[model samples]
Target: MRSLAGLAALVAAASVFLYLLSTHLPPGPTRGPPGSAEEEEVEEDGGVQEYRLKFPSDLDELRELAEMLKFYNREHHGYVLLLFCSAYLYKQSFAIPGSSFLNMLAGAIFGPWEGLALACLLTTVGSTFCFLLSSAFGKQHVVQRFPEKVALLQRKVEENRSSLFFFLLFLRFFPMTPNWFLNITCPVLNIPMPIFFSSVFIGLIPYNFICVRTGSMLSEISSLDDIFSWGTLAQLLAIALMALLPGALIKRYGEAHLKVDGVDSNGPSRAEVKPVRERW
Candidate 1:
């Protein structure tokens, strides 16, 4: 209950901060700063119009929002970046969904290369923040809420303990399991921070790249279907399969010759698995 309360309080605080930031921002596409040449150009094009600054639910809304931000980015560039980062981190830290829209938005505003870089960086940092928050405040609540899931993942982690990093990579690349669940449950699995961080940063590059690249052509995208079509899914599955190969090789090699504390060299000795279970 204390863990639940702590998580609730932190989430509420983050929500309020984002709310305040959103409300304070200028609401529409406007000219550059006063007396600037861009201001005249913007005025000649037409005065800024109101647009809702909210999470877009569809492609059309995403395009509108992206255009609005791009227009705002002209004059309040720093604020635009801060707003994007803050919102991205907020969703990530809280395990909220809908970041695909934001990734595309970054591409639309920052262009392809910059957007991909920003998306990858933010995905890593934001996910790490989520991991830390889960470790700090949500561990107990997560275990209680999803006992079976917790047990299953714990078992899988133990099974892949020798090649945990590749297993983590496989999970990220595959997307069979939702990323939020991993972020929240990893601490409970006792995965090391460095491994978790590295896996997330590296594992998500392809996913982030696709989103940002699609965002670069946001104007042409008619629907989310275009983003996650059969081809893309197949490609991701291929990458996920490749990720598993290293872990498979590692496990096979370990079983064939590995020894634990001078124990049997055939398979994972009882000695190897005992300590991990004891820790849990």
Candidate 2:
């Protein structure tokens, strides 16, 4: 019952927040002239369908929103920025999907450089909120649900403590693992906040630029695949490899120095250098 009440409260709060946000925005386009093709389709589906607003999960819906915002770009710039930032933050805080659409929308509305900056800033901020929120509310649940994975991650983090920042950079750059999982696990693994923030801010630059640039060319993109061609993927792979290089070098040099000093690379050496007592 407590859980149910909490869930209800969360939903209510989100609804109120969204309602407030919507009220501040410029009105959407008026319904297509009555009895036009859009209305005809609505009538064919029954009037009930026309009144309901579905969640913006469909690409068509996102594209439509982008189109609508384009009309108000010059007139209501502040409101648009506020709305975009708020919505993006909310999405990230809850680990919601569809950020790809938002990234594209940023490019479409702000152009590439500005869009890239916005995407990175909003992502870092939102992800910070997510990290803190997960630390408070979801950490135990995640640990309970995936003990083995958590343990493995903990071990890996411990093993790479010296180069953890670079390891994090690699994770952010490549994103082979989901961001939400990383947000949750990083807190649980006790990674420092500064390191997490720095790594996320810097490591996301290349990928964010790619995503934003794709948005700048929104008109040319017919599918997501079009944005991530083989050439693009290869470039991204190269960037990820580059990000990993520093950590790899650090580890390699540290191992070499340890070997030269007659120390075990994996552990302390058994041999000890002791001062010999002088014969008096």
Candidate 3:
């Protein structure tokens, strides 16, 4: 009950903050002319009513918003940064979609380097918030909901305890696993906060750079599919494989050494490997 209350308070506070912050943003694009399709509706009585339809907050709306903001970004750069970071964090903490659009917008408006930096920083911070939130209020529920997955992840964590950092890097660098799953499961697996932080920060760089660069080239992109061609995925997979190599090497060599020394792979240590006494 206490945890639930805390979660509620946190959500309420975030909502209020976002509401206040949004008040400062420039007005949305002006409505189209009176006879525009968006503003025209046919009534049952055969009369044409001008009823403007509000756009939902989705990729298309986000892109339109980004386009509107581009005109004012240079003059109100600081406010724009604050707005962008706040919106990104809110969406991430709540597991909302459309961050892909935000990533691209960042590149389009801020350019590649600045956009990448912002996206990376905001992503780490937002993901960390979600991690802490789940640790505090949602871990048990998530574990109960996905017991098999949790069990599998637990075994993987135990098996790779010595190479956990590299495992995390591989997970982040490759999008084979969803990041929200990692954020929620890491706490349940008892992964150290520092390891989680470092893995998320460092591991996401390559992928985020790709997203940001794609955003910078938004003008040329006809769809999201264009951003991640086979070539791009191959490059990302190559980097992920490289990240896993060091850990694999360490584990392989350690096992070989243990085998050579007559140490039980999963049992007693070298000290226990002694000759038996002749006397019964």
**What C-alpha RMSD separates each model from the true structure?**
8.5, 10.8, 11.0
Write model 3 residue lDDT over 54-163, tens digit each, in one string.
22256566455555456456567877788778888987786666667778778877888899999899889988988999888887777666655555556556667887
> Tens digits of per-residue lDDT for model 1 on 89-119?
9988889999899998988989978888989
Residues 1-280 of candidate 2 have per-residue lDDT tens digits of 4544554576578768866776655643333335555456546665422222223565667556665565455567888788778788878777787778888888877887789999999888888887887666666666666555555556556666877887677667556556767777788888889999888888777667766766667634667896688866665576466546654664465455322232221322223422221111
lDDT of each: 0.75, 0.66, 0.67
Scanning candidate 2 in windows of ten residues, the lowest lDDT window is: 258-267
TM-score of each: 0.74, 0.67, 0.68
Residue pairs whose backbone atoms clash in candidate 2:
none
Show pairs that collide, candidate 1.
Answer: none
By lDDT, the candidates rank as: 1, 3, 2
The segments of candidate 3 whose C-alpha lies over 4 angstroms from its true place after superposition are 26-59, 220-280
- The alpha-carbon deviation from the true structure for residue 85 of candidate 1, after best TM-score superposition, in angstroms, is 0.4
What is candidate 1's TM-score against the reference? 0.74
At residue 185, candidate 1 shows an lDDT of 83
lDDT of 3: 0.67
Which has the higher lDDT value, candidate number 1 or candidate number 3?
1
